[model samples]
Every structure is written in structure tokens, then in C-alpha cells.
Target: MSEEPGPVPAAAEPTGDGLVQVAYLHPHQVSHSWHESVMRLVMYDQLHDARIVGTAGPLMISCGSGSLVESRNLAVSRWLDETPYEWLWFVDTDMGFDPDTVDRLVHAADPATRPVVGALCFAARETHHDGMGGRRITAVPTLYRPAHDPQGNVGFTTLFDYPENTLLQVAGTGAACLLIHRSAAEKIRAEHGDVWFDRVRYGDGRWVSEDLSFCWRLGALGLPVFVHTGVKTTHHKQVWLSEADYPRPGGGEAAHGR
Candidate 1:
């Protein structure tokens, strides 16, 4: 697609009570050969599914991680601030979410609970005692910890004691998948810069991790990210093994660019 910045008005409308804002992180991060078709059939089509329920509609934004987090993350943030919705779902290109996903996610959240602003965990964390604090929680075995884990060493939870369903202040949140409420995003942008995904390799703390720094900033502000264990969406990355590469019914092979 186009490389320009700013929010692209979604062709769809809201199907649910929540304002769904789907943002793609590092569309360029994946291998180009599978980029176009994957996005259209999977990412785009999935969002389109919500049209039946009025939970559809999102500002599609693509940005390179590092510096100018404000300009990047805030592009959508600004658009969202101008909108009337309360909850905003920030998704990467890898995410596969639909109306059912939205409906279920909202149900998973506690109505009596105050607003939470943290990374939504589709992948469940292993629980020992169970607790919630600082508005964050870490997976028992996070997808990344294994890669960095010592050979044969069972990695432990970075922070312990969290509620089964509650807002957790995690050390960092991944842009790969996160559901941010409008008030939460506004609070975050005011404190830190913008949402950084670390798409760029050659950068410092601010350059490399948007999700990471985002949680830190949100936690610092005491905004807990409400963890919805029930809601989850498939994440599609730019890779040969990605499920998004699967062909559509009655279709040929997936093309490179859309």
C-alpha cells in the first residue's frame, strides 16, 4: 500500500458499542512476497466480517518503529481522540479479529472494573498463585522468553501474583496485539511519546520497542491494562510459514503485493 502517514478512513462502520481502531505494525517487517495478498484476504477480510455486527471500522496505520513515537502512534491516537468511542483496539497486521472477537472481548472485561490500559493477552500466561498489579501481567511462558531462555532452564514469571481476570501493569506490551481504550491512549500519549513498535533495527530504547516502553509508561501512570483472557485473534506476520499465506477458496496462489 501507500507509505504515507496519517489515518486512512475505514470503508466499514462500527458494528458494536466499541470503536474498533485496527492499526498495522511494520507492514514492511514481513517478507514482501507474502505481504499484499496476506493483508487483503486475512487482515482486511477479517475486519470486514464485523460489518454484520456493526463492530467494524478502524484507522489503518503503518509505521516504522523508533523515534517520533508520538508522530507514529499518535497518528491513530489523534484520530481516536476525535472519535466518540470509548474502547479502541490497536492491532498489528498479524492479528485476525472479527465481530465475534470484539463481542467476546468486551464480555470478558469487568464492567465494574475501572478503565485499564495495557496489552491484551491472547496467549495465556501460566499461573502459579495468581494476582494483578501495576496494571500488567506476563505470560507464564511468553513467546519471546523461550528464544532468550537458558538451555533447559525453566524460566519463571518476571512478576508474580495477578488476578485471573484483571488489569495488569506489565513491563512492556507488544504492538503485535493490544486493545487500548480511548482514555488510556490519551493518558499514555500525554506522558510518553507515541506507540513505538521497534520496526527499525538501528535504534536505542525508544527505537527498538514500542510495546515495551508503552507498558512502562502506562504503568508509571498507574493505568492498568485490563487483561481479557477470553478474547484472542490470530497474529499474521510477513513470513513464509505464516497462515495468512494460505490460498482463498477457488483462488490461485497468493500474490506478493495486493
Candidate 2:
């Protein structure tokens, strides 16, 4: 990946008559550090003419014993039903972005082209198998592009060498920081009911992540998901780290520092 920032396309100024209502939804826990990161973005980021709603403190209803998925689902459902917001921006507490992150994401989600846009963020996963007798760990970019096998089965993997500063169609992505249109949310609710985010079992009998499950539901309605690579975000795991600290896909360690 290039060390320099990618070129950002100019976004049109929002007219008074074209204001968009947006709810900044944060699914948080008891981490003060992450909470502060969320506050900084909410306080400083430019979100076009969006009227931001929601807060960084206890935004989700408690589901007892750290039910992250259920909490997020309840919060999103309430926002869709009670608020007139045209968009829902889900920013996990552990995620940080530039001041123009929201603006860039909104620009990418042009109603005429893209309805759902996710920012590029880092994520880590661990898998265990009795045959291996140990856990295998993998860390990579969560933004993904879809692919198919010769047998016609769909699959997803990180775009390790994707072109810079472009909008790429994705099968799904981690909702750590994503911009979603109300129209898509409404469609899912009307067809699948209020259970918006959760682990869903696919035909292969494997449980999909909550983020992918939501994307799959939207895909069923012909809505496409995209990742705006121009708008990069930092996943604040363990301690604060920038994009440079992220482990590359193939093999390499990023410089680690404060």
C-alpha cells in the first residue's frame, strides 16, 4: 500500500434544502480510551450537512453480559423506527477515523450509485481446529471484494492489493465504521423483521458474522455494498495504532510505536 494519502474527490457543498438527517450510532463498552476516540470524531468530524444524532455514552440498550450483537441490533432498530434520520452511521468505539471520514463516506454513498459504504478498517480473527491442535490467527483488512468458485459458490476475501482511492464492490464488511441508508434498513426490517444484526447460518451451515449477515440481507434486495478505500480508518485494538501498524496481508510487520 502507498504511504501517501490517496486523492479525495471533491464533494459538493450541501445546500440548506438538501440537508440529510444522520444518526451516529456507537456500540460501546466500558473502555474509556475507546469512548474518548468516539467523542473526538463526533466532536470534530465534518459530516456534510448531516444532523448528527445519538451519543458516545451508553448508546445501546444493555443485553446483559456483553451482548455486542444484540445491543447493536436494538440500537439500530430504535433509530430506524423513532428517528427520521435518512442514514445510520455505525462507528464502533474501538475505531478512529480522519476528520473527513464521514464526509467521504457520505460522498461515496451516492444514492444513484452506492447505497451502503464502509470505511477500510483492520480486523483480526482466530480459528481453531482439533486436527491442527492449535489456533490459527490472521489479521488483515476487513474490506472485502466478492469472488466465485468454478462451482458457482460465492466467497469473500480481503483486497490485499486493491487499487488505491477507488470504490470497490464488496460482498460484505465489518460494521466497525459504515454508512447505511435508511431505505436499505427499512427493506430489511419489513422483510426480515426487527432482528437486523446477528449471526446467521448460511446454506453451508457456517455461522456468518453479524456484519456479513446484515449485508447478505441487503444483497437479497438487490442492494450492493461498497468499500471506499480513500477513507481509511484506524482500528484501535489493545492500544492506539495507525495504518502503519497494521500487519500486511502477505507477510510483514508494520512499525509499532506509540
Candidate 3:
């Protein structure tokens, strides 16, 4: 990867009529909780649009089908090739979020600078410390910061001590609730030729996820990735996980599980 920042394209201004279009992109399948959360978000978006665009309606939704990577790539292609929306918001079917999640992320983003913004989400399953460090279920955040492994290979590690209720720049984050600008997408497409989301095999023989891959590309292009900690989200696995469940070392609270 180039240490020098790739040239950032100018961000697109809102339409002459003061309209800012946003497309809601999702993968196949939907849970009841997620559906309800999205409905609330859409309702909020409708009101926002009415004030901004002089009309009110649901956001343009595009759902992709297939495997995770495939679905994401398909959604990206559709958003770039088929839609006229200025923003693409990726929301997972298992995610629970506030109605203002979209507004928070959009307000935090500056496409010319911070083009990719994501809301904080916890890992669905709790993890235990390696070795005989004791068996305590620790809740982990999806945010990541760049670091080198013991083997001297560059990679991203989970950000455990991030500040809450603030917008913080990060190396990457989960795609559960991410917002992308059209300019960022165009720059990425010009550089990588449509290979937006794909798993990468690192020098250490470890595979990084598609979301991290996309984030790395954005960083290479001089676009910063930000996480709005105030916009907390839930990741549903066998159980629901939220910010309250995040690990707080020495905070006296019990671990997530026994």
C-alpha cells in the first residue's frame, strides 16, 4: 500500500433543489428486530427528506442476495451503476440501531475528507483471553486500528479502548451500519476497477474481511474512516449485544457471560 495519500475527488454537492439522496443497501434476509429498527429509521429519513427535498417517501432500498461478500459487492455495483443516490448506507439484517443512526453518520462525514462513516457495533459472540489468562467472556467492539503483529506483518487490531459518544477515526469497522459517499465509491472504482469488497490474504497468512479491505482501500486513497460512538448499535447472534455489553476492564461490572 502506498504511504502517500491518493488524490481525493471533490465531494458532490447537494442537488440544486436542496435534495440529498441516500440509498439503503442491505443483504438478503431480515430479522423482526432489524425490520422494526429500519422502519423507524426510514420514517425519520422520510421526514428529513421532506424538509430538505420538499417531498417525503421511503429511502431507495436495494437488497442483494447470496454470500456476504457477494451480497456486498452486488449492492455496491447497483448503487454505483444503477442509482442516482449521492450516498449509500449499508445496514445489515441483524443490526439494531436508532432512528437517527443515518442522520448521525451523514452529519459526521465529509466526503472530501472522511468519506466512510460507521456506527459502533459489538461482536455477536463474546471471546475469552488466550492462554490461561482465565476464562471470562469479553465483549469486543468492531472498530479497528492499524498495527503490526509480533511477526512484523502489518494488519489491523480491534480497538478496545476507544472513546464513547464521539466521532473517532479508525482503520476500519464492521459493515453492519456503514455510510459511503458517491465520490469515495468512484475514486475506489477508478483505482481498483470494481473490486470493491473482497477478503485479503495478509503476509502472515491471515485473511482480512471484505469490510476491512474496503477500509484499507479508502485509507490508501486518503479518505479517512470514522466511527460515531454516539450512534450505538446492536449485533444479534444467539443473543443481542450492545455498548453496555462492551468490555470495561476493572469497571467492577461482571463479564458478559459466565
Candidate with maximal lDDT: 3
* Leading candidate by TM-score: 3
Error of 2 at 185 (Å): 0.3
Please provide, for model 1 over 1-258, each residue's C-alpha lDDT reduced to its tens digit, 9 standing for 90 to 100: 111212211222223355455454454564333245244434443565442134445554555554336544664555555666656655555445443544444444332232432334344432333232322322331212111234443221233333443333343445544555566667756665455322332122223344555554555576554444334445433222233436765786666776
RMSD, one per candidate, in order: 14.5, 7.0, 6.8
Candidate 2 runs further than 4 Å off: 1-33, 45-50, 53-58, 63-66, 126-138, 147-153, 239-258
* Local accuracy of candidate 2 as per-residue lDDT tens digits, 86-188: 5667777666677667767877675534678888878866544324354444568886656665666665556676657777777788888888777777788
Candidate closer to the true structure by TM-score (higher is better), 1 or 3: 3
Residue 208 displacement in candidate 2 (angstroms):
0.6
List the lowest-lDDT window of 10 residues for candidate 3. 1-10
Model 3: residues with Cα > 4 Å off, grouped in runs: 1-28, 50-66, 126-137, 239-258
Give the Å shift of residue 204 in candidate 3: 1.0
Q: Count the backbone clashes (under 3 Å) in each candidate.
A: 28, 0, 0
